[model samples]
Target: MKFTKETRNAGRGRRDLLSVAGAALATGLAGCSGALERDGDGNGNENEDGNDGDSDSGSDGDSTDAAELRETLAAADPYRMHQYGPSHVGNAGGAGPTSDVDAVWTFREGADDSHYEIGTPAVVDGTVYVPENHSVGDDGAETVVYALDGATGEIEWEWTYPRGTAFGSTVVAEGAVVLGLGGSVVALEADAGTERWRLERDFSDAVTVADGTVYAINTTYADPPTLVAIDLETGRERWTEPLADERMFWPTPPAVADGTVYQGGVELTALSTADGERLWSKDFGNAVTGPPTVTDDACYVPLGDGTVAALESDGTLRWRQSVERGGRGSGLHPVSSPAVADGTLYVTSAWRLTALDADDGAQRWTTETAGDRPPVVADGVVYASGLNVMEAYDGAEGDRLWRYETDASSSSGDKVAPVVGETAFFPSAGLHALRGADATSD
Candidate 1:
């Protein structure tokens, strides 16, 4: 899809201007409120000195001034993926907005066209990154990646590829944005839209990065599939391992935790992240729908037959539960991955959001909704997107808190999982920036 910059509305009233500024400031503060440091392993965590190693405020004090916090937040780009990490746990970690939310901005492209599709966006620093695909006459389709101001909905930079379509979500890692284009994995400079490097391969899923390495899957209809790893910094080939002898179709992205890379297709496969060696594999006799959610002790795989299997880290089966059994004869199972937070697993089946005990696979609660995208958890609340509304519920009890109507269609197959920072970011027809109704009052 080709995108041209649209003019920004300059007729906003004083109250609207203040609202945008306040939302931006809140987003900055929220980014700074977390542990922004990266340890020696490059995973984000506090340093041994009990301070955020990435903080520029230094060891002089724990409190940071507003100016320094804003700068730090803008540079950190906290929430950048679908579920906040490669595991697809969908937890935002810190506090998120709780009160009723109002739209701060809406960004749209080709507003009159109905044939274009927008992929899920990645939010970092203060910018929203989105990829759009549209058909081009009788030839192939085109894909365009865009960066928009998170607060104001203004385009910052956009790059179009004339030959390929980007169907998977984008990943932002180590100062660059990585995505799959046709038969290649391309990395672009996040700030300038300049090409860093491209690795040619038939990538079937989105790219996942961990400990400085990029992991992706390559598949063909009649050929064996392979799991390939590349160095994120240089885009150099690291290792490749044949996944299976049979044809693997629509492989889910690999989730790396500890030292194991978990991928699911016809079965669940675990491989060593060091050399792409297969450690273990299990056949559920059913196709695994989405990427497996990994934790320190267990791996959760969602199946196409409405069953969720919890396996031990070493590939032992813990338990399996059928959360949704073709609700009302619809014969639809969950295609979205499960999100884990506070010892609870959140998943969507048919038209309901179900929460289960992560350890024992026990049902906790279920709430009726209109859509089936995975749910996101932050600060003891779960945010889910229904047909045309986003709803927030208390995490522990599944009690509804508030719902905000949206203009975007939730049935587009482009799952809309809200990205939480100081405010909640939702993407549909366009991107929407929202803040809690009680934010200013608090």
Candidate 2:
């Protein structure tokens, strides 16, 4: 859905703009606060710093997490989800492709039509799953989901629907490529690009997988929006719940951790992954601004008020850290989705990046003008994207190591995170795979 000042409630006016812009600013740059749109390829991670690659919410949550269906992807080799995993840690283990890197390969999908933007990317095993939009017969447009070889830009397999287009992340689960395609939740065979199952929805932007279930928001014209859960193997609805009727923030793609699904709409809500049941709910004076980043210990919620509300599993308030100002068009601006590593939380607030102590919400370090795209943390580096630049910073010291300038995707709400592995795969003008300049090209 297109978000604008005229459509949203007064409380959510300024909060939803961070994604409208690109990369969460360069070092201390400026966070985006325009219009959050989408159109792109989606991708997946490794665990670093002695972090258990698998989240141990320390509860029964782990047992129910079907993310293991894509087991090996837990390593950094594959970026299975948009934010890396069900936990939404946004870490893909090792280091990022530094600024000195060179483009290993690029799959340009630019067309004359404005809606002909590429989708995000998802990497698993050695295949990169992405979507490319194309202008068809004059004003018509269609998106093609392609499974490309990771090492080479060869199209291993591709698929599209009749006059259908896709937006948001591409996910791999239950041994299939899952995506919000053709206005439906689609699962296609990873190796052959064959349809496995399809669940129709009038509109959907993001799709996430957990414990053999697919979670996403579905809407039909004037009907109220509903978050629906679909079985991974079958195209059957498991449960559906009505979303907040108000003009609130509902993260494009919801997140799941510890057997709980986290979403932002009327409020930050935690629901059971087993069934559509509310586990807990909290209000921080405004709707949730960005995707909830869930870790082993806390569920960090970015609020429209420029505050990061740290809450426990039971919805208990842990702490709140304010940004330069509220999400409104005043001070620094509100914060967007954050990446947590070790014990520090890397947040892109308006035109800056701030590192906060995960335990007490104390500021560890802050950048000057930050990029606005959601940050992806790996090894010890944090990567933030912008419309024309990608900045890498030391995860510990917050020092700007290097910056690479490139054309970011103009797709609506194209806030897809960067994929970190042997090469850094960014969803931009198309799909750009960057690697260290010293690395030998195959």
Alpha-carbon TM-score of each model against the true structure: 0.78, 0.78
lDDT of 2 at 437: 51
TM-score of 1: 0.78
What TM-score would you give candidate 2 relative to the actual structure?
Answer: 0.78
Candidate 1's residue-wise lDDT over 214-271, tens digit each?
8887754326878889998899989998877865455666888888899777788999
**Alpha carbon lDDT at 137, candidate 1:** 58
User: For model 2, how does the per-residue alpha-carbon lDDT over 1-442 read when each residue is reduced to its tens digit?
Assistant: 0001101001111222232221221111232233222222111111122111112112123323223312323355567886788777878776666545545556653422233355568888767888766655544555678887665555788897655343567788768888875457788988899999887755465678988888988743314667799888887889987665645334456889877888775577788877778777776767566678988878898766677889888989999988653132334355777788898888776547788999999999888532566788878888876443456788888887655444332344545546545466665445666655554222
Using lDDT as the measure, which candidate wins? 1
**CA lDDT of each candidate?**
0.64, 0.63
Alpha-carbon runs more than 4 Å astray in model 1: 1-77, 109-112, 134-141, 325-330, 409-414, 438-442
Give the worst 10-residue stretch by lDDT in candidate 1. 51-60
CA displacement after TM-score superposition, residue 188 of candidate 1 (Å): 0.6
Question: Local error of candidate 2 at 387, Å?
Answer: 2.2
| Alpha-carbon runs more than 4 Å astray in model 2 | 1-75, 109-115, 164-166, 220-224, 245-251, 325-332, 440-442
Tell how far residue 153 is off in model 1, in angstroms.
2.2
